[model samples]
Target: MTRAVVLVTGPDQLALWQPLLTGTERTSAAPVVLRRHDRRSLRGWAQRVEMFHKEDRLERLHELTGGWPLLVDQAHRLHTELDDPDEVLRRLAGLRTDLTRAREFADAAGVYADPLLAAGYRELDKEFADGSFDWENTVTAVALGGELEEDDAHRVIACLDALQVFDRDGVELRLEPLLRECVTLRT
Candidate 1:
């Protein structure tokens, strides 16, 4: 028997890929689903990262980037880029993950010509201003706030996911507190 394992990061990607594998499985005609890990898994990842990098800075990296595999990979690169953990973290903390990420997503999705994504992103920026951007309420908040529709919310969320602003889940969303600080900066 042949088996395939796919790593899906967010809802949009899942929607994109799930259709392709609808009936390819041998025994079962249903699509296979896998559960993602919780934040607790970060501890083990932190240890592994610490060992690999030979830097006792995974905890700090996790504090900044969270446990998402991609973010961890970025952290690893950042680890190689700088000698001091404090300087590395300062660089990370100074990033505008929101803006840069939005641009990347828009470019990737070929939506740079459209203002909808930018407008939706600004709505999210406003939402993150005084309080938190609730993952669960993201669509509703943006829709109700007249920034975007539910469908557009998915696109915006996809952008944010790519940027590591929010870790997307089916029913709930998790925010990386450190990056969230960058998103919600008042000044």
Candidate 2:
């Protein structure tokens, strides 16, 4: 027997792959979700792109991106193309100080360009329109006083995860800092 491992990656895995797989195939498939890179993996990616010269700058990149691959790649591209990459990183890292600056950075990064992420953002924005959500709270709180069924809450959480809007540590879910800033600023 030949054994093969297939990896499926996209903004929405279910939407991308579900239609093609039969019910038994879907049930038998073992899915492994890939999360953001860590410092080590970030270093590896940076080295491959020949952007690993400055230790401090690399650390700053890690901090700013939280290992989010798209943001990291964007930062790397800006780093290579721009005369002063530090200034760019500095501005993005300091977005918390100015709402306008945050919006500009978010726009430049094409944060909502991905359809799945845009949909997730819209869902989150609609759910937490007041811009007051407790990150430490469970997904049940996302339902907002039982408005959504338990399955709906799970689906929402799954969608957010697929969009990389938040990081899940065991049972806890914390929104990505940069995304949180952008979302809150928009609200």
Candidate 3:
């Protein structure tokens, strides 16, 4: 008799299982990391949006989103409700403070249901409200005078990255311009 139990977390279980279960005796499947699109790749994604084939519009979208795929996808989804794609794209680009839009993003991104992530966001939100966006310091504060371990802080930061709440390049962590503006307005 054999018993097997499988536990999976996150939005994509297949993304986890694909590499782990595909290894053979002598060869292992190469891991694939799906990164957010950069400007050039974002241009390609914009072009694929139905009826949006103009180069100038694509350029505008690229400039607005800074190559963030979720922002690009949100703009693409706006075409149906609004008459002018360009106008709608512009609004979506600048509408981060809209409570409705924020809730939509949180829901779609699954951050709304996560208490740990919510706490982290609250801490960062307070820092943003205070005109200081020092994420490293924020992480340290959240960890409570070294009470929490470093790995836990890293995991929180990683979750924030996955939520597109901010960008991390090596040691530098900064909020996206739009998110900063939104936080400013709310405060």
Off by over 4 Å in 1: 1-39, 51-58, 68-71, 78-115, 128-137, 147-164, 167-187
Writing each residue's lDDT as its tens digit, candidate 1 over 1-187 gives: 8887655444335444333343223454343443222445666665666633334455555565545455555656876777565667666554446566534433433223235444555566566543554565777766767645576566555554544445554555555454444434422
> RMSD per prediction, one decimal?
6.9, 5.6, 7.2
* Candidate 2, 126-181: lDDT as tens digits: 56543445443435565554456655555555555655666556655556666667
Q: What does the lDDT read for residue 38 in candidate 3? A: 59
Q: Comparing candidate 2 with candidate 3, which one achieves the higher lDDT?
A: 2
Candidate 1: what lDDT?
0.51
In order, the Cα lDDT scores of the candidates are 0.51, 0.60, 0.58
lDDT of 3 at 160: 60
Give the winner by TM-score: 1 or 3: 3
Among these predicted structures, which one has the highest TM-score? 2
Native-to-model Cα distance after best TM-score fit, residue 80 in candidate 1, in Å: 5.1
Model 1 error, position 40 (Å): 2.9
- The estimated TM-scores of all candidates read 0.48, 0.63, 0.59
On residues 1-187, what C-alpha lDDT tens digit does candidate 3 reach at each position? 8665546344334345333433322443343334556566775765666645678777777666655557766676677677588787679765565776655555545444455655666666655543444557767755663346655665565566655666556665666555545444443
How many steric clashes does model 2 contain?
Answer: 0
